[model samples]
Target chain A: MRRVVITGAGTINALGRDVATTLEAMREGRCGISDLKMRDLERLAIRIGGQVHDYVPEDRWNRQQIALYDRFTQFALIAAEEAIQQSGLSFTGKLAARSGVVLGTAGGGLSTSDENYRTVYEEGKNRVHPFIVPKLMNNAAASHVSMEHNLKGPTFTVATACASSNHAMGQAFHMIRSGMSDVMLTGGSEAMLCFGGLKAWEGLRVMSKDACRPFSLNRNGMVQGEGAAMFVFEDYDHAKARGAEILAEVIGFAMTSDAADIVMPSKQGAARAIQGAMTDAQLNSDDVGYINAHGTGTAANDKTECAAVADVFGHHADDLMISSTKSMHGHLIGGTGAVELLACIMALRDGVIAPTIGYEEPDPECALDVVPNEARDAKVDVVLSNAFAFGGLNAVLALRKFA
Target chain B: MTVRDKVIAIIAEQAVLEPSDVTGDSSLEDLGIDSMGLVESIFAIEEAFDISVPFNANDPSESDFDISSVDAIVAAVEKLKAEQA
Candidate 1:
């Protein structure tokens, strides 16, 4: 089996518009969440989010392209351009035929749907935009990425709620490892901070109005975020042959279903995924130095994730530095794992562990070293990014420092 | 129907029990009402009474709206109605 390595990484999140700015924010423990400025903000109980400010589409795209692209698709395209450019590989001939795009998005073109629903139902309009269906489809981002890059291989989108990005990235990794593809463009994007989206989430009552205080005793719930992060996963041999800059090696990936509850997370299921990833990578528990936790700040998720870590790592769980960047960037739902993976890369590559900001009082249930409120510099050989969705789907990816 | 009766009716529907089987002192747990059920019940109460309840499903105990028992939920709904009025 061929080994996989990430040659390029790019992102546009609440913390920053590109990879460098985002890592800098993570290093500084800066909080990007603020009072959300969107249409019909008064109707939402959860008023704050990690919204990307001043993201005007006209500045980036032409009118015809804007007509075809939704906000999520636009974010994906922007990130993909940065990632593909950084990879320094043009998709043509055999490369173009073997390369693919796999993206994850839970609420694709939700803003478009929300507006059109208001137009027809609320305003009693008889017609809608002609490109509504194409723009709102879940695979729109993946399709657009493939088309722009001229990738003709296996291309699709994965939607497993919050675990979407991890699942999509994991599949991309396998596709390369199994010799189905030599390179894959993989990541996720979400732009769900609209009136209808927030309204639906508000019904569940799992959103924090003030802040996302992950693993804190005073933590209320998760805060929604919006953005995209994309990466180029290439075969190690392929990257080495081209002398491409290696970001990190995709060593292992594992996904599991709780089959227990739709909303509540299961510790055993999460533990299994963690253990499975380590086992797949042939890495011992002691080898992992940092973990990007799926800490949504909800009362259910943090405790359950901590318990799973404890169960999987045992005594090493105490020594392992785990942090949730979600507290800084907020929860992007489907797009979250892709953004959080940047923290893991930072840990393995730069030896900087992203801090879980907004951490106030520590919860007894989550007593592990969360690297709270301050970034830590430590040489780490391996790291894991964990994503557990609302549907009891858990995906974990293991990465190793490139030698 | 009275506020208590309406609250009991909503709880019964969530628990899939008869209104006659529900009592003021009965806890939601005793009636097999899960977290999702509680959220639906809260929404039903909000729509029925036309008052917003300050509740967070992540930590029900931390929420200002009491949900300890049928009587507590009814009392909390009454307080919200009075405050909103």
Candidate 2:
């Protein structure tokens, strides 16, 4: 099998607008959850979310681009611009035909759907916009990314709720390793902070009204976040041949389904995915030094994730550092795993373990060594990022420091 | 419509049966109603009575509304309607 390496990374999330700013925010343990600024706030019982209040689309795109690009697709383009620029590889000729773009998002164009629905239903309109179908499709982001970057091979999208990005990136890695593509633009984006989006989630009753406190005794629930993270996954030889800078090596990836519950997380299922990733990477428990947890700040996820990690690592679990960036950046849902992958890169590249902020008191159920409230400096060669979504889908990725 | 009659009518519609064929003791599973049917039944009931049901699909045991049997669901709905009154 061929080796896959991440050549460049870019992100615009609740934490920061770029990879550097995001890593710095993690280093400082900054909390991004605040008062949501979306429409119809009074109707929502959950008032707070991890919204990107600083994002102004007009600053980046003009009237024409804005009309064609939905908010989610806009995020994908912005992140892709930084990632493609950082990679320093111009896609043309053979490279253009072989490269691909795969993105993940549960709500592709929720803002568009929400706006049009209100116009037709509430306003009692007889007609709708002409570009509604293209803007609201699940593959819209991926399609636009491919067109923008001249990538013409194997473009698609994934929509597995919270696990979407991990699954997307995992498929990208497999594609490069199997010689289907030499380079791929892979990550995720989400823009579900509209009134309709929040209202639907409100019915689920799994959201925190005030804050996100992952792995804490006083934790209420997960907080919704919106943004995107894009990365360039290239074949190891292709990157090295061009003298492209290597960020981290994608060594292993595994996905598993519980097939048990629709909403509730399964510990055994999560454990299998964790173990599978480690096994696929040919690394033992001792080699891994850090874990970016799936911790959604809900009562069920934190406890279940901690149990799964403990079960997978055994005695090594206590020594390895685990933290949830969600407590700082909030849960991005479909786009979450892509953003959390930034944490693993930070650990493997900078030896910095991002802290799980908002931790007040430790619960007995989650007794692992969670770096809480403060970032820690340590030597980390291997790291794992976990994403367990709703509907019992779990995906885990293992990364190793490039030698 | 009475709670029992309305509830049975929704369930029977999902099951493709006459309302008279459905009994208060009939379990949702026995009536061949799946989760999708259950959600549709709940929506139909909500629209029919304009009453919200406090059902937790994740943990039905903890929810105030009962979906164990048709009779239990009727009792729960009547209680919610009374509380609203």
Candidate 3:
């Protein structure tokens, strides 16, 4: 099996418009959750969300294309553009045909749905927008990304709720490992900060009232965030042969389904994913220096995830630096795992662990070195990124510093 | 004021436009009212008149009742109110 390594990564979240700014904010323990300023959100029960405020549609897209593409796909295009630029891998070569794109998204073009619903309901108009179907589908983001970059190999979107991006990355890893594709653009995008999107989450009743405080005793619920993160993954030898800048090698990946509950998270599922990844990587628990937790600041997710970490790492769990980037970026839902994976890769390369902001008064159940509220400088050799979704879908990816 | 005036007022308020901007024959799209705004307006109409609007966006033209224009909205609201009474 060929080894898979990330050559470049890009992200746009509530924290910042690009990867460098976002990572710098994370290192400084910044929180992006703020008062919601979206249209007609004043009357809603949940008024706060991690909205991407600076994003504007590129001039390259026509008016019709703009109308058809959702905010999530717009984010994906921008991030993928940056990733492709940074990877320095030109598709002009033989890499064009062998490359693919696999994106993850839970709520795609929902904002468009919200808009279409209003046009029909309040107006009593029979003339529906022509771009409704193209705008609202989950696969639209991946399709747009592929169209933008002309990636010919296996292109699709993975929809595993919160674990969507991790699943996408895991699939990309396997594809490269199996020699099915030489390069793949993979990640997730989510733009569920709209009024209708928040209303749907309100029905679930797990949204936080104040700021998100992951693993904190006073943590209320998860905060929804919107963003996209993408990575250019290529085979180790393929990248090295082309003199590509290798960011981090993906050693192993595993995904597990918790046939347990629809909304409730499970420790068994989380532990199995971590263990499975470790086994696949042929590494011991002690080899993992840091863990990017799936801490959604909700009570169930934090406790269950902590227990899973303890179960997988045992005594080493206490010493391991565990943190949730969600505390800063808010929960990106489908895009969470993809952005969190970047944090892992950066930590492995930079030797600085990003802080889990809003970690105050940690619950005894979640007693780990959450790297509380302040970034720590350490020599991180191996890192693990975990994502557990609503349906007990758990995915984990293990990455090691490229030797 | 007539029901037509009240309906125009409601549409104007809900769509965040001037009352004069919403003519009796004006399309909702021309008034800058999207689907989400339409839903909000429906909720507002329900609360204001204390009558349920048995309408679905998916099946907007199912009933003889329609709300495309100020006159139609007022007529629909009045008919629904009379039925409840």
Candidate 4:
């Protein structure tokens, strides 16, 4: 099989609007979770999230594009523009036919549905927007990205909840490695911060009203976040031929399902995915110096993920540095893994490990070098990104620094 | 029904047992109520009493609303009602 490498990366999350600013924020260990700004905020039990502020949609898109795009779709298109621009490869002729886009989004156009539902039920209106269906579709972002970039190959969207991005990116990697595609714009986006979304999540009662402190004994629960992150996955040979700037190499990917619980995570299932990824990459436990944990700040997820890491790495678990960027960016739901993968690439390329901020007290159950509160400088060659979603879906990706 | 009786009724319904079979000292687990059941019971109690119980399913023990026993839940609900009043 041929190898795959990341040629370009772009993101517009709570941390910052692009890759450079996002990595800079990660280096400083900033907290992006704060009081959410939305309509009817007083009705929510949990009002804080990693919301992107100071954004103007009119500044980026025209009237017609705005009509066709939802909030999540807009985020994806913006990030995709930056990614495709950075790659410096314009899809044309044969390249256009061989390239495509695959994105992950659990709540595509959720805000649109929420608003229309309110219009019909609460306001007793018979009419809604004409483009509501197209705007709110789950694959709207992928379709738009493909159309914008002239990609005519295998384009689709994956919706595995929190693990959606990892699964989508994993598919992209496989497609490139197997020569099904030469270049794929792959990532994820989510904008589920609407009133209906928050109300539905509040019923589950796993949300924290204050802060998301992952791996900390005083942790309450996860805080929701909204945004997107996109990447360009290209064939190694094709990229090297064009003299592309490679960010990192996608070495391995593994996905597993617990088939046990719907909400609660399983240690055995998560451990198997991590182990499977390492085996696929042909790397030893000692070679992996960093891990981006799927630490949701909930009591169950943090401890469960720690146990899985310990089970897979054994004694070397103590030497590995693991941190939850969710502590800063909050849980992005389907789009979370894509944003967290940026931290992995940053670790492998820049040697700066992102910190798990808001770490007040270390939990005995999650005893490891969490890199608490402060970013650390660690030279790491290989890293892993873990995404364990609800419904027992687990996806792990292993990456190596391209030499 | 009194606050205690209402609390007992809710817990009993979640456990799928008659209200008479439930007692104030009975724990949720002892009554065969799991985590999801506990969450439903909390919702029922909140709807019946019209009071928001400061409970988080992630860490029930860390919550201010005591869910240790039926008696504890009733006491916490009564206190919340009085404070809200």
Candidate 5:
């Protein structure tokens, strides 16, 4: 099996438009959740979300291209551009055909769906817009990324709710490790901050009235956010031979499904995933130094995840530093795992652990050292990023500093 | 004030349009109200009148009811408010 490492990473989140700014905000424990300011939404009970403010499409894409792409796909393209540029891997020769793209998203083209539904029903129009189907499909982001970058290898989109990005990245790692591809761009993007998406989330009854407070006794619920995060993965020898700067090595990955409930999480499910990754990497529980938790700030998720960590690591959970970047960026749903994976890679590289920003009062149920409310400097070697989604999907990625 | 005048004012405010721009027969599309704008309008009406709207803003097809015009929205709002009472 070939060793796979991340050569580049890029992100656009509520904190900032790029990876550096986003990472700085996370280190500082900044909370991005604020009152939503759409033209409407004057009367909704929950009015706050992690909305991407002042993002002008004109800055990233032309008017014609913007009209063809949904907000989610646009984010994917912009992030991919940054990752590809940073990777310094030229797709000019045979490498072009061997490269692939995989993306994850929960609400692809939801804004487009809302727009066309209104046009057809309220306007008495017989036909929908020509770009409606292309824009609204779940695979739109992957398809757009492949087309934009001319990647010809495996291309698809994973749809595991919040775990979508972790699953996507895990699959990419497997593909490269198996020599199926030399280069792959894998990540997740989401743009569900529109009024219609907000209304649907309102029905779920898990939206926070205030900002998301992960692992806090007064935590309400998760805050919705929008963004994209991508990583360029390549075989170790290929990256080294090309003089590419390796970001971090993907040591192990595991995915499992609870299969017991749709929304409720299971500690057993999460424990199995962590164990599986450890077995794959041939590492003990004590090998991991930091954990990027799914930590959605919902009462059930935080407790369940904490229990899972305790079960898998035993007493080691107290010594290991664990945190949720979601406290700063809000929950990016499908994009959360991908963005959080970057945090893991950076923590392993920079020897710094980002904090769970909104934690105040500690919950006895979640007694692990969460690196609460402030960044901590630590020499991290192995880092794990955990993501659990609706329908019991759980995915975990283990990363290590490049040797 | 009549219910009609109040409904028009609510629609204008919710849709972010001038009061004079909305007419009883003017379709919401013509008045530039999208689905999100319409859902917000419904929410505003429910809050203003202290009632619950029966229509599911999430599932428009299930409702089978249209609020495309000022008169139609007013009728829907009034019907929901009366039923709540």
Candidate 6:
């Protein structure tokens, strides 16, 4: 099997607009959850979120590009620009044909959908925008990335709720391992922090009213976040031959469905994915030193995730450092796993474990060694990133430090 | 109808069984009602009784809603409806 490696990564989340600033924020335990700045705030029950601040699309894109690209797609393109530039890959000839883009997004073009819907219904407008369909489609980000990079190979989108990015990246890793594509422009983007997005989630009542406190005793629910994280995943041999810098090696990936409930998470299903990822990576439970948890801070997800990890790792669960970056970045939903993967990279590459911020009192149910409230320096060779979606879809990825 | 009868009827409707077939101690798992059916059963009970159930599917033990048997569910729902009234 061809080994898959990460060549470059870029992100624009609540933490920072670029990789360097974001990683630095993680190292320092910066909390990005703030009062959401959008119209119709009175209508929303949960108004706080981790929104990307001070993003001026006009600085990077023209007026025409701005009109064509929604907030989510603009984020994808911006992150992709940094990632591809860092990768230094110019697609032409066979390389162009062998490379493609696969992105994950739970709510693609949500801002576009919200704007057009408000225009039609609330404002008494007869007709919506002309490009509404093209702009609001779920595959808009993947399509735009393919067009911009001239990736003629297989291109598609994955929309498996919160696990979208992990499922998409898992598929991309499979393609590279199976010799389908030499490189994949993979990761995800989401802009679900708009009015309609918050309104819909408010109905579910899983949103935190105050702050995101994962694995904490008084935690109410999850806080919604918006942004994108894009990565360049290349074949390891291909990356080494070109002398490109390797970020981290993608060792293994696994996905499992709970087949239990739509909203409730299943412990058995999550455990299966975690154990499966370790088996696929050929790493024992003791070999893993850290984990980026899918700790959404909701009453259901945090405890259930802890139970799953304990079941899978057994005694080693106590030794390994586990943290939920969602406590800092708020839950990014589909784009979350990709951003959480950045934490795993930071753990293995820089010997830093990002802490679960906003943690005050720990719950007895979630008694794992949660690196609470502060970042820690730890030399970990292997790390696992977990993403469990709303529909009980679980995707776990195992990464190793490139020796 | 009594709360027992109504709850049994809802569970039976989900399991494709008659109220007579659903015993007080019959488990939903035995009736072949999957997790989705269980959720739907809870929703129907909530709507019918106009009371919220403290059911957490992640850890059922942590919730107030009991799932050991039909009798347990009926008792919990009755208790909730009484408290609401």
Evaluated with lDDT, which candidate comes out highest? 1
Candidate 1: stretches off by over 4 Å: none
Q: How much lDDT does candidate 3 score?
A: 0.86
B22: Cα error in model 6, Å? 17
Across A1-403, the per-residue lDDT of candidate 1 in tens digits comes to: 9999999998999999999999999999999999999888877789999999998999988999998899999999989999999999899999999999999899989988998999999999999989999999999999999999999999999999999999999999999999999999999999998999999999999999999999999999999999999999999999999999999999999999999999999999999999999999999999999999999999999999999999999999999999999999999988999999999999999999999998889899999999999999999999999999988999999999998
Model 6: how far is B24 from its true place, Å? Answer: 19
lDDT of 6 by residue, A1-403 (tens): 9999999898999999988888999989999999999898987767899998778889988977777899999989888888999999988889989999999999999899899988888898999757888888888888899899888899999999999999999999999999999999999899999998998886564677788889998777899888889899999989999999999999999999999888889999999999999999999999999999999988888899999999998998999989999988889899999998899999989999999999999799999988999999999999999999988999999999998
Per residue, candidate 4 scores C-alpha lDDT tens digits across A14-62 of 9999989989999999988989999999988889999998889999889
Residues A217-287, model 3: lDDT tens digits: 77878889999999999999988998989899999999999998877788999999999999999989899
True contacts kept of each: 1.00, 0.00, 0.00, 0.89, 0.00, 0.05
Error of 6 at A285 (Å): 0.8
Which regions in candidate 4 have their CA more than 4 angstroms from the true location? none
Q: What's model 3's lDDT at A47?
A: 84
Angstrom error of the Cα, residue A111, model 6: value is 1.5
Candidate 5 chain B minimal-lDDT segment of 10 residues: B56-65
lDDT of each: 0.95, 0.89, 0.86, 0.94, 0.85, 0.90
Q: Whole-model lDDT, candidate 1? A: 0.95
When 1 and 6 are scored with TM-score, the better candidate is: 1
Worst 10 residues of 3 chain A by lDDT: A202-211
Better of 3 and 4 by TM-score: 4
Sort all candidates by TM-score, best to worst: 1, 4, 2, 6, 5, 3
Winner on DockQ (4 vs 5)? 4
DockQ of each: 0.96, 0.12, 0.02, 0.87, 0.03, 0.12
> Which is the winner by lDDT between candidate 1 and candidate 5?
1
TM-score of chain A of 2: 0.99
